[model samples]
Target: MADGETIARERIERLESLAREAVAADEEDRARSYVRRARRVAERHRLRLPRSFERSTCDACDTYLRYGYNARSRTQSGHVVVTCDCGAQSRYPYE
Candidate 1:
């Protein structure tokens, strides 16, 4: 049997893929809804998202971010900054 964290991670992965597909199909609202659901799953299971997905989600509104669309990215001082449509900003350092 899978542990709580494992199950949550699987759900998050599935949701993220679905969100991406929705975005590719130009269904922005549907993608956002999927992202919101994924965030709730993570919260309920007390699990943190993987690093790759972490940068693709908005912390404030739980919306999935697509660069050059609903999200913007900029690099400064060795860090990549992501700004979401909901006015949430996240920074990650890259080497």
Candidate 2:
């Protein structure tokens, strides 16, 4: 990987950690900001966000999702369904 890619990855990691901390502290807006920034860095670097991070974020509102807190999760039709507080739903297939 290039130096830029390495840097972007580091930044994304940092942002993700900060976002988690913010969410744990009940600062939704701050966590959302971190999520948005991480996405922007990934886009600018043409890098894919990690799968876990992607699934833990709301695509519509860029908010960090905490299952049972700001989001709801259920299994249906062989897929895991995640629903955000903003009424957005994401489904991922399960084995």
TM-score of 2: 0.98
In candidate 2, list every pair of residues with a backbone clash.
Answer: none
Give the least accurate 10-residue stretch of model 1, judged by summed lDDT.
1-10
Give TM per candidate.
0.84, 0.98
lDDT computed for candidate 2: 0.97
Query: How many residue pairs clash in all the candidates, one count each?
Result: 0, 0
Q: Which has the greatest TM-score?
A: 2
The runs of at least 3 residues in candidate 1 whose Cα sits more than 4 Å from the true structure, single-residue gaps closed, are none
Model 1 accuracy (lDDT, Cα): 0.86
**lDDT of every predicted structure (CA atoms):** 0.86, 0.97
Least accurate 10 contiguous residues by lDDT in model 2: 44-53
lDDT by residue (1-95, candidate 2, tens digit) is: 99999999999999999999999999999999999999999999999999989999999999999999999999999999999999999999999
